[model samples]
Target: MIEANTPLLRLLRTYWPLVMLSLGLLIIVAIVDSSGDVILAQTLIEGLVRIVIVAALYLFIGNSGIISFGHIGFVMIGAYATAWQTCCPYTREMFMPGLPVYLLNNSHHFVLAIFLGGLLAAVVALISGYAIMRLSGIAASIGTFALMMVFYSIYLRWSTWTSGASSVIGLPTTTTPWVGYAYAVVAIVGAFLYSRSKWGLALRSSRDDEVAAKAAGVNVFGQRLLAFVVSAFFCGMAGGLFGHFLGMLTVDSFGLGMTFITLSMLVLGGMQSLTGAVVGVVVLSFLIDILRRLENGMVSGLNLPTSSAEVFVGIVIILILMFRQSGITGNQEVYWPFKGDVSASSAMKRQS
Candidate 1:
């Protein structure tokens, strides 16, 4: 520990300039982001939502070294939970006319409903993680994707609860742009904190090589499960806000379409870097918005076909994967301090 700390302390002193630059950029992003018009502001908040979700992915995929194709299931569950709580049903005047006796129909409290939505997702993750984590490589990815598909099928058929494919309308528009941005910042900070914690190290070790890590007494299954479930919780929260923000949600938001879009954002930034995920969400989301605008706007000669945005993002992802296979950061991060690099080493050296 002492030996490592000396090198870490030296690195911190060595790279203070980089540290300052990063902090300055973050402050600027927060300030400028908050000052935009409501429409643009909302878009920015949505960007933050993606940032948080992608950051969580970085933790699991980046640290635990597992790719999840269907984690959107948690978000689907979350969107419905919040939508059900906040919307007025035909029976209850509060909900609509009246809610079922046991359904807990009030969604007025923003903090509570959103947290509950996230919690519900986490609970689902707890169960799902156990089953899915048992698999490895492409097998685990396929298994998780299957789970997402199964959930999607259920949601589409469960008209009594999810409103099926028609659409879930009347979700109260209480999720503000600010709240979304706040949560995004929290997610980024939290992910950074988690990935630098002791558990993160174990998770990363597992990702790098489960057999080797396990040989050192690491619990690979547990690590992957822990990382994945945490990521799922935030994804659910992001979805809940998404459902409410638009004042309605469709099953499609939590479908394969969203799964790919969000994953593409993460992939474009970098599969291995938390920084990459954050950047990926910010940059790709804006590009997507631009593509959406182009699709909506008539071209110089003719109107573009519908769904062009999806096509564009898909192409972008393909190019990124082809050209930049290491993923945004190759599992590297800017916070080398907490990453147990020089910072941790410095502490150990000081103690020594």
Candidate 2:
């Protein structure tokens, strides 16, 4: 039997598996970097960003039981926000001449830029989530998809601010594997803490039974909106990291393809648990990388078509959903010492 402990200690106990998994990935990244493979290093950086993004998704969707397609809209906003604050003066002047005098004239530090980017996205989420969270089920999902389309259309046309369909260039590229690793750790820890918090419990209660939760005095909409804003903050930071990683930003980069990819990662890993998000991203990322190698004839004599990776991923997703809709983790987290199933009653009591 487990002894009663402080919330912090219990939180750590419940999430130690996730923490160790992240540390293990960081070690792998270090090993890859040590091997002097710049290409692998870059790919790992990309995977790290996906881990952050998917973790953000889990923090909101997993706890709240809401599926949002518009989270990537926050990502777009964050990327351009970082670009506006960090891009060179000449680049801004040349591409975004109509920007405010303060933004147009000065470039900020990368850290500050990332913070502001995330802050901006969080602010937007706060405003938008008020209405969006009031919606439920497929309607809520559609509302979010509409929000994404609106953002996409505006970014595609607002040339002065977003450079229209063109890419925003000349931003600093300072994201190393270490930096990505740091953010991934932050994402993992932050998500785990939130999942075990009072608000998280209340949200999950509402998710499981809205009528009972309402009877118990839970404010479902408020909880959902709170999660939305917090999730957007991390997603925004992911976007900023992505911008700095690639040193470029385009509206299309955060469009439908990105939405589907991240959602797939979340669903494939198990949408109900944090471990699912991390495992899903790592597994699928490596799978895609391996398929890409095969496509390039790097693996034996097999030379698959350029689009084979996507096809394989789609097939795999279908198979997983058909056989195990809860994903690889089956809506359960990875616990320490032994991989045993955790019941909801125990989790709730521990949080209490």
Candidate 3:
């Protein structure tokens, strides 16, 4: 058993493998990108952004065993919030003229704008979680989906603020592979720490057996809310990064299509494991990119239709689910050779 007084250093040591593996993958990608392959670099940035978003999803969905379709809504909020703060005065004046003087007059730094964007999503999550967390099973899932629709509708119709359904242009193209790599590392560390923390354990317990967890005095609702808000914050930051990466935003970018893609990535990776989230995003993103290139006739002599990539992805998801419903990693973390005995002992204790 881990002692209550276990040193922080010990905890950090236990999770070092996870951190190392994550960083190692990013380093390999960075090296390849250094060859000046712009397409590869963009793909790496997109993969890193997906990693951040999927990691956020894992924090809540993995621990709580809840599926939330509304997270993309938070991403939309963050992206637009970042745009509002970072766009030049002239751009904001022309596109979003209804803004207050503070937002209209000042163009903030990218870092500050991204931070505020994440914070904004967190606040929204907290407010919505109060009511949504009360629900469970399919009801909670539906409620979250409804929340997404609400966000989508509001952003689509709020013409003065969001430019309605039209794409919002003039965002700074500031997200590079290195910037994405740094954020991805931070997100991995945060997810790892939280997963090993007491609250995360409690939430997982509640997820596995709500009745027993409640009987043990775990505040399931509160724990779920905490996870939800934390997840939203990182996801929002990812949205900010994505907006800057693309230099544009539209309701379609954060709508059902995006939600489906991100959720598919999470599910493919083993939604219950942090390592799975990273691996899933990296593998699927690369696969999609390759398929897209093939469709564009970059490799082979045959040029397939644009929809071929989507078709292939859909088929892959179906096959994976049919074979490994729990995902590529199941509920296990990445392998740490020296910690085998420790993990075995913990499993024995839990069973007894």
* Highest TM-score against the true fold, candidate: 3
The candidate 3 region of ten consecutive residues with least summed lDDT is 1-10
Candidate lDDT scores, in order, read: 0.73, 0.88, 0.86
By lDDT rank, best first, the candidates go 2, 3, 1
- Candidate 3 lDDT by residue in tens digits, 1-352: 3332347645555876566656677676769677898888888888888888999999999999989999999999998899899875678887888788899999889988998999999999999999999888789899999999999999999988888878879888998888888888888888888988999999999889988999999999999999999999998899999999998888778998888888888888888888788878888898988888888899777888898877887888898889997788775677544443456546767899
Q: Is candidate 1 or candidate 3 better by lDDT?
A: 3
- Residue-level lDDT of model 2, residues 1-352, one tens digit each, is 4542668656666667677778788787889889998768878899998889999999999998889999999988888998899986676888887799999988899888888998999999999999999998789899999999998899899999988899888878888888888889888988988988999999999889888998999999999999999999999999999999999888989998889888999999999989899889989988888888889898777899998988898898899889998999888776554333255645776899
TM-score of each: 0.82, 0.92, 0.93
Ranking of models by TM-score: 3, 2, 1
Task: Give me the displacement of residue 50 in model 2, in angstroms.
Answer: 0.9
- Which candidate wins on lDDT? 2
Candidate 3 has which clashing residue pairs, if any?
A: none
- Each candidate's clash count: 17, 0, 0
Alpha carbon RMSD to native, model 3: 3.2
**Residue ranges of candidate 2 with Cα displaced over 4 Å:** 1-12, 338-352
